[model samples]
Target: MSSVANWSCTATATIWRSLGKDETGDPLGYTEPEQILCDYEGGLSKKLASLGAEIVVKNTVWTEFALAATGDYLLIGSSTEPDPVVAGADEVRQVIRYGDTFERVADDYAILTGI
Candidate 1:
């Protein structure tokens, strides 16, 4: 299938939030992690709220964050652009064929590749 066909499904960021505990396993209405990384706070909260959970974004990072699986709520990003990458025309064309966006974050990712 063409990259565009694959991308037809849309790109999203899956976010999970940890709900504060009330001493028992139940949620205390507030989240313990206290923050989420996103490009937009209101948009993220609105999307999460639609999923029957409320999220308060404390901050946003250009890169994605991974939660440790103790999450209580979940959210998917609504971004249309793909993550950037520095690649030659062939590489870029290949990615385009898969309908994937290749964003090149301005840092040398070689060191962070394994992390």
Candidate 2:
């Protein structure tokens, strides 16, 4: 696998994982926002191709989030950006398949993808 120096750019995102539901079946809460590297691209297309689909990929931004699986929601954007793109668990998981390595970092797990 390539080193971190190979990564071109980076972005910040927010992760929201479900910690089960409350008595009313509502999600508990979301963890504080954490900054991670958005080093990869074309992940969505790669996943579709793996499924044998021939769809045209437009200006889609399939960034890589190497955070722990503890989160179920991933919002890609910077504080300056007007809006953030939210990704569900399945979408994030698909991108994670292209990760380079999986290891434990501190008290959480991390998946490093891209060059």
Superposed on all Cα atoms, the candidates' RMSDs to the truth, in angstroms, are 16.7, 7.9
Candidate 2 lDDT over residue span 20-107, tens digit each: 5689977565554444544333343332446696534221223344444522444544332222222321212322324444433222
lDDT of each: 0.26, 0.38
Q: Write the per-residue lDDT of candidate 1 for residues 1-115, one digit (tens) a residue.
A: 2233233323333332334567677754422222333232222221244457644443222223333233233233432222211110001000001112444322110001100
Measured against the true structure, the TM-scores of the candidates, in listed sequence, are 0.25, 0.40
Best by TM-score: 2
Off by over 4 Å in 2: 1-9, 40-66, 80-95, 98-115
- Give, for candidate 2, the lowest lDDT window spanning 10 residues: 106-115
Q: Give the Cα error of residue 70 in candidate 2, in Å.
A: 7.7
